[model samples]
Target: MGLERVIPVAEKLGVTRPEAKVLTVAGTNGKGSTTTTLAAILAAQGYQVGLYQSPHIYRFNERVKINGIEVDDQVLVEAFVRVDQARRDCQLSLSFFEATSLAAFLIFQQQQCDVWVLEVGLGGRLDVVNVIDPDVAVITNIGIDHVEWIGDTIEKIAFEKAGIIRPNIPVIFAGQQALPKAIQDKAQACQATLYAVNRDYFYQDADDGQHWNFASSGSTLRLPLGHLALDNIAAAIAAIQVSGLDVSEQALVTGIRNARLAGRFDVRQIAGKTVIFDAGHNPHGVEFLLKNLQKFMKNHDQYTEILSIFSMLGDKDINSVVKLLKGCILKWKIAELNVPRAASLAELNSALHTENNVEQFENIKAAFESALAEVKDNQIILVCGSFHTLEAIWECLEEWQ
Candidate 1:
């Protein structure tokens, strides 16, 4: 509902304003990766760090982590108990996101974390995580997803994300797209120093394509490549730099090399086949996935067939994303996800638009099994579309193991 509902419970739980340094990340994409990298770097610097992210791939414990380790079930259960009691005393109802976020705050507060890295679950201004004012607010990128909840235009979405900016704080805009005026105006109104990517800070591939360089007016760091995207890594570094935190160069490099998020461009060798799992359901995210896929292909042997296990939520822009990916995907194994917003077979077929290299399955496990059985030595199977799509396959793999 409103921030008022969660704020009171958070205050009652003694987590409304954490004593630790807060770095809040918000965007249409890259929020999870950026937050993960930030926490990893701070932890590498020997700080007690707490990280909170959303839409976990496998387990609920993945939502709350300390020192790069997912907290145990007992920790979450304890925090949830506290939050539930507080909410009951306040007589307020919370959505799953709001309740879990407050629980994360309670855990971080109890652990006495040195740094709190929070990922905004949705639009920034109204998100439960925004209850704590961030010392460094990072907007990884803005895209036209979540239009039904946020807005239909990029500017409108930017305005909602800009709600995370606070007075006299450092704001990092790392979106590759043009800088939205709404963000600039909000930064000005708040008197926050804005470090827009490609303007205040820059990143490029070094002489060796394997490594990259990040340069700002304050410092320059040559970093090793990691599992996440370079832009997100750079954004995390910039936020740390502006945060006035004491992070060593070694910590920066080591953390960059060590940081990993499960479903973003995740690769695995399963059943003698090359499989990639990504949670890119929107056009912008899919575009990023394609670029990384192209790079992977360039560095490795070409696959004779690129088969995709695809599904999407009904709210997403399925047509644009399908068209953007059609050029690279040779065949598609579409399945209907068992979620309230999942797309129907008819809707998926409409998006396909005469692409005959397609097969429909009743569920994700069957589609994945068919892909595994049919994939040959020279074939690559891509599991994508939504987080739900990847989560289904991951759960199935766990069961089989």
Candidate 2:
């Protein structure tokens, strides 16, 4: 199917959208995390939840899951068949993203999901997923990404993300974005109950290293996840409370600790080194990941060297992302990601700034090999920059070991 076919078919399918409550997520970086967190929280509360995310690094089925299990391949294929046939009559074009978005929505309808957590694939206003009106809308930390499709300024982008907030819906944001008042006006126009971080709910890391304190208008609980995750956790908890699900603080803490969303700072063992992976596409996310990685490294002992395996698409703010991770990256093994929009080696080099300690590889596997050959025992080998880089290395690591 094509982008044109995505909407009409989705609109037709939505006419019979199954008996399911909806919680929509729209943002720049934290959409997947917040969606996964809410899915886990609701699943722990004994509700059958369906989650839909985008830009899967590993598999197409990663986009749709129920209670953390990827929807069966058979189910996905059949749903795709229906959507394909539906579009055949119209002969409409559908992008890869559009087709997958519609298929997943249809699958959610087929399954009797108690709650559906949907993340906008791109800008909220025109995104295929926006065809579904979400009950509880949550925007997590709006930042600059998709500048061309959305807008140039943060306020313009926020306006688009804020489009998901429907009338009378209580929209819980992770924090007040550094955007113009136009964004606030748009949310007010939609009649969404805006609750920014530190306003409707507040979080403070306790002086003790054990736990962090999270307080909302409804309730407060000391969370198990660290500060980096509190914003996401708090957003999930706030949305759950607004949903009136009666999920307990114990469930929140347990779910937060147990929540393991892949491709988000996923750490694994490879060739006796700390193989860290994060799919931080844009600069904002890269900044956050670098900050967390530094803190994590500082808190740990016996780290020898930092080797980075990096690649990115042509579209991203590659320079900023690379610069953020470059200072401490003792060595760089640049490679090509197996993706259509991959940035060439020359483009990747622009981010390196200094010419020293950099090497080029045919692909991510080659880069990983180079890094592995040189790294010390127990040293960190971070495979980051883009999902394509991490995804390629992730697949290769299975065969390497």
Among these predicted structures, which one has the highest lDDT? Answer: 1
Q: Give the per-residue lDDT digits (tens) of candidate 2, residues 130-247.
A: 7777888888877877787888887888878787777887788885554346547866888877777877888877887678887876666777763335678778888888875668
* Model 2 collision count: 6
Task: Kindly give the stretch of ten consecutive residues in candidate 2 with the minimal lDDT sum.
Answer: 1-10
Best by TM-score: 1
Error of 2 at 29 (Å): 0.8
Clashes of each: 0, 6
TM-score of 2: 0.94
**Model 1, position 306: C-alpha lDDT score:** 88
Q: After superposition, which runs of candidate 2 have C-alpha atoms over 4 Å from their true positions?
A: 1-5, 15-18, 226-228
lDDT of 2 at 391: 80
Query: Per-residue lDDT tens digits of candidate 1, residues 261-316?
Result: 99898989877689999999899899889999998887887665689999999989
Task: Give the TM-score of each candidate.
Answer: 0.98, 0.94
Query: How displaced is residue 19 in candidate 1, in Å?
Result: 0.7
